[model samples]
Target: MGLSALFRRKPHERAGFELYGKAVAAARDPWFFGPLGVPDSLDGRFDLVGLHVALLIRRLRKDPDRRGAALAQAVFDAMFADMDINLREMGVSDLSVGKRVRAMWEAFHGRAQAYEAAIEAGDAAALAAALQRNVWRAEGDATPEARLLAGQAMRVAAALAEQPFAALLRGEARFPVPEVPADAA
Candidate 1:
């Protein structure tokens, strides 16, 4: 279904889907990704950026007009993610580039720099092992708190749909920005 339907919150009713609505809600809120798209649960700056950017992209699609600081931040975050991915891809070693590439397949997967270093050092076996391990998966099911936050973010995103474009692309800051906000604290 189109985002129009996605953003169009239905009547108060329990959904058949397990917290899908909550997920949608979480993606909308500006604060969902933490300060300046910093990954609350992972390593690296771009990771957070990509997360927020992805959410912003969804929100923008639903309502292009409501592109604000959050959307702008998201775009910037996405761009950074792309750059990091490209850099990480490039720095991969010939011996294990393929292995590392496969291991790094997950979108929101977390990992230590050692893995990247292994890829850079050309350890195909390590990279392959890492990929096969799939270490990021949690043992139990997703927490109720997570689902609630996601739903809230989705609702926030839906509400933020009517923003303006200029806000997202304001100033000269585009790619490789030095600072996102003057004082986010």
Candidate 2:
């Protein structure tokens, strides 16, 4: 590649990382753990981050430009790199980190597929069920929190759908803040 092309690529890569950071920040919002009842634990946080990233990636994949696809891959790479660092900080042994990361990747893909299908079907019940199974891992009937979380996810997906492709390409994506239900207050 020419030097000018290489230089231009760096900005897009940086933008991808910046966008990934936004996803992580949204996932770590205290409302999710408090009113939303998303468990405030490592796994819970990881799942939230994964969900946001998946939604963004899905949107990026729909863009007509090839740059969107490249940025999406960059975001994915950044997410996994952050995961690896997090695992080490959590005291996971280096030897086992790869195995654990692999498992996490599998979980991510599974959740992404399920979420994509549910979102595409435009069925709230299906989305709730998928959220219950993946996010809450609840058995039997869905819990109230699972339903609330499903509502939040649906809102996020809708908000993302409305975002202009130009903004997304510029890494200016934003997810609407989930409103806490009145009953939860």
Top candidate by TM-score: 2
TM-score of each: 0.34, 0.89
After superposition, candidate 2 runs with Cα above 4 Å error: 1-11
lDDT of 2 by residue, 9-98 (tens): 554677688779989988888888887777888888889999999988888877787788887888888889889999999899999999
Number of backbone clashes in candidate 2: 0
Every model's Cα RMSD, please?
Answer: 17.1, 2.8
lDDT of 1 by residue, 1-185 (tens): 87699777432112211122223333334553554332345333333333334444444444435434344334434444444466566675566655654444344334323234433455544433432232223234434333333333333343444444443333211222122233334
Cα lDDT for residue 40, candidate 2: 85
Candidate 1: where is the Cα deviation over 4 Å? 1-48, 63-136, 139-141, 169-185
